[model samples]
Target: MHTAAAVADFHTYPLISALTHLERLPDQLRVQWADGRVSPFHYQWLRDNCPCPQCVYNVTREQVLEIVDVDEDLVALDAHIEQGLLCVRWHGGHTSRFDPGWLRAHAYDDESRAERLAAKPKSQLWDRAFEWPVFDYAALMEDPAALLQWLLALRDSGLTHVRGVPTEPGSLALIAKRISFIRESNFGVLFNVQSKADADSNAYTAFNLPLHSDLPTRELQPGLQFLHCLVNDADGGESIFVDGFAIANALRDEDPEAFRALCEIAVEFRNKDRHSDYRRLAPIIALDALGEVAEIRMANFLRGPFETSVAQMPLLYRAYRRFIAMTRDERFRLVKRLNPGELWCFDNRRTLHARNAFDPASGARHFQGCYIDRDELLSRILVLQR
Candidate 1:
């Protein structure tokens, strides 16, 4: 039983003072905070989340007590506030202690959950006129602070330009290793972006590649892409970029039905060759749990035939065409000529990339490319901040 003396001593425990009341019910416990917010926790949940050394390993941080070992109908026989912690003695002779701060931090009430979800960082949408964020490659490679700022710019704007990189082979891989290990695919660790005699994909040709995301056929697409221009003395191989998220949001605002269809219908993406065959079925626009656009997968060259029902085929095509048109719109597309010694990096999941047709006989246009997962870039940013 809780006593008045224990409650009076809460002033020393600032966390305990936040709790206005605690009600021990038959199967669960309800805590009313000083702010008038009520949070409920089941007995089993509290037991599972117990921070005591007996229940959790102190060094490994792993849970020692299995949920099956606890009684399914266990109840708190007695509960009290002791030294800023909520102490509970269970019916089976097991005791648990919970810090009020932990409880408040891990609150799962409707209001708390909503607030947490709303606090997530949102990407800043951009159009063709948006100025590209540029950083010195030498400074970024030498200084940790410059590297973090460049990475954050990529995270927020979905694109960044790094100039003054040494124009040489394998430079892209070295730059990529600064953030994390390169994400290797069938193309190899460091792929060449030059015209080939018999190209496996359109990206290897000198033809004007349509604006699209890379490797959509794979189940797990690469998150970040690095393209280092070693030689771009060509006539007309200008680079093009479009923000897929911006176009996706525009579709959602202008034609909600089209947006819904794109999000609901799953299309097939396939990459088949003599040596390898990869395939995946995914929606063009993937929404997160909060119904916000999380990723955009669009690759016309790799997109296979629609496998949806005949009735839905027309709707899917309409939405697909609308999205493709939006990507090509001059207002959304940014065209720039990447010069030698310049490195371009962008979010592969958010930015659609393309190239203009160049005359192979005009001059040489060579680039080294590599990929890194999105999580790696984000992790580096967090560690740098610390």
Candidate 2:
């Protein structure tokens, strides 16, 4: 029977390993080890990492490692008492353990080595390199399964290329049918046209569009943007792209309050250039009413000025400028030479796509592109991944 003095002294001890086996126990706590030795530890270490609430994974999947197996392991042995304890500690850490007998039974075993590996870091939701069927230009777009697989891969990758596609008028239509939504932009396609017929007009800087989400000032900015390059050759025409979601997440992490300011303040964007065009006003850092982040808006052309109270305007503008810096940073920007028959699609709500002027003198380039709703891509991916 235990005494009050022993119980009090137990708390004073550091729960050292050597003393574990010394604790009196029933006949059930014995086991052998890989090195042919035996040992027995008390319940202390056994309860430490038992996949309990105090452990990880919310104590789920307890059966992944079983404590029951240890019950049959306890036994008597002729092994030395101290070495026996060491053996029990080691074996107990595995699936089972031995008190003393099992150690002598396995006395001829050799030593074993074991260690745990570190966990993996998280990946960007849009980084799809690990998925199946890498983006290759050789694959044909005709096969239904192959076509569907290709489109889904495009969605997962947040980028894709269509090869051998016709470069004529209706090519964009066929391409649009493969995907559900469409984002029609100023030009039928994002072209770096440099043909002699376009001598005076170096492909559009008649424009220097601001870095902004396509239409995020709206409730739903086009989720996807498709750029099908039908031509490529130029001195000044290279497309600039930035992954807006990555930038927004970075800002959110770097300074949550600054991010909060962006999420809270409403900014106005207006451009009635042609065709029933209208403007929208919303937070530069758009979030659904649920507080789930939906999109970002930072535009020189569209967004005009800060509308918040005088006090909040300065803070909001500060975050706005920081966001622009992040988006333009080389770390976040992806510059690519879009060539013919190459179609790239991205989450426009989460990516800001742009282009620089090129001399149309040398030659011409043409690209036909469009947009589709973002959720369509997500819904399709969920269905497929499921």
Candidate 3:
């Protein structure tokens, strides 16, 4: 039988191993599991996570008790294992019960923590030779498994294609909604990609666009980008994609100094027009807590003049030029001409995209684009997984 604490959380943590014994200490409780794993839970942590209806709201299943409300020196007067649960009575009249399943799942033991870290999904880097991951739009729209697979490809590989899409002007919205809500920017919810006489950005004109991430001028760049081809009757304008992570990793292996320079120096990215002017200063590459390459921000057109110390100017320029040259390298580029009724969805931050100049006079070309944050994609994936 599951305790009230186990049923309170959104996730159902299965009993992986049963609790064998519990020992109470001055400040924490030591637990021993059937799997021979020892975990220590501090008295404060247990009290703060109490899932009783009095401590946590029953409807939302959210914790209502704040740790500050309880005494900082709060000690458990007694703690014992009863009915496969860890029950703790506080020095005061308060009490907290932890389910065996939940406790094991959240165990902070070194071995358990390492196991969890190892099981996390990691990016599968790829280059020009990557077998393009393509999915049928109809399947993704109707089947949960197919949708999950497509999202996983975008998450791991950073690039994906969807075929058999309707060529309607606004059909991109339908497929975008399959993931989650669209992220709105200064360019609007759904932006059109076509040549215009009065253009605000280089993307609005028929020009050879350099490989770059979209909207680096913003504080938080969009995670996923959807560009759906409605009409591709024009000549040229073939899409070019390069795995930014792959290029970054190659730089790290080949020239550690350049990689370090890019990661350390902050540059300015600006987007200005008659109506709006946005700018942001950040390093070209960002690392996560574990010192792994987590993001890449590159937009040659949107970049302002490089501003750095006179001593480091040469190194910064050398690193910047090297990174741009790598993007142009044939070994890293994957060039493809998207046809009507097809859409390209990719990780905007990790996949640098470009376009060859097309002749607008030859014929007409039109595409619709939108953005979605990473949180939405991960949240949808988790819900679909459940």
258-306 per-residue lDDT for model 1 (tens digits):
9999999999899888899999999989998878888889889898989
lDDT to native, each model: 0.86, 0.54, 0.92
Q: Which stretches of candidate 2 lie over 4 Å from their true place?
A: 1-140, 148-157, 181-210, 288-292, 382-386
Question: What ranking of all candidate models by lDDT puts the best one first?
Answer: 3, 1, 2
Worst 10 residues of 2 by lDDT: 112-121
Model 2 whole-model lDDT (C-alpha atoms)? 0.54
- Comparing 1 and 3 by TM-score, which wins? 3
All models, RMSD in angstroms: 5.2, 15.5, 1.4
lDDT by residue for model 2 over 309-358, one digit each (tens)?
A: 87887898788888888777777666666677666666676667777766
At residue 242, candidate 1 shows an lDDT of 93
User: What TM-score, to 2 decimals, does candidate 3 have?
Assistant: 0.96
For model 1, the superposed segments whose C-alpha errors exceed 4 Å read: 1-21, 34-36
Could you give me the TM-score of model 2 versus the true structure? Answer: 0.58
Clashes of 1: 0
Error of 1 at 242 (Å): 1.3
Highest TM-score among the candidates is held by which one? 3
Could you say which candidate leads in lDDT? 3
Tens digits of per-residue lDDT for model 3 on 1-386? 55444557777777889889888888888999998999998888889888788899889998889899999998988888878888888877887888888887777879989988898899998888998799999999999999999998889899999999999888999989999999999888999999999999999999999999999999999999999999999999999999999999999999999999999999999999999999999999998898888899999999999999999999999999999999999999999999999999999989999999999999999999999998889999989887
What total of clashing residue pairs does each candidate reach?
A: 0, 34, 0
At residue 6, give the lDDT of candidate 3. 57
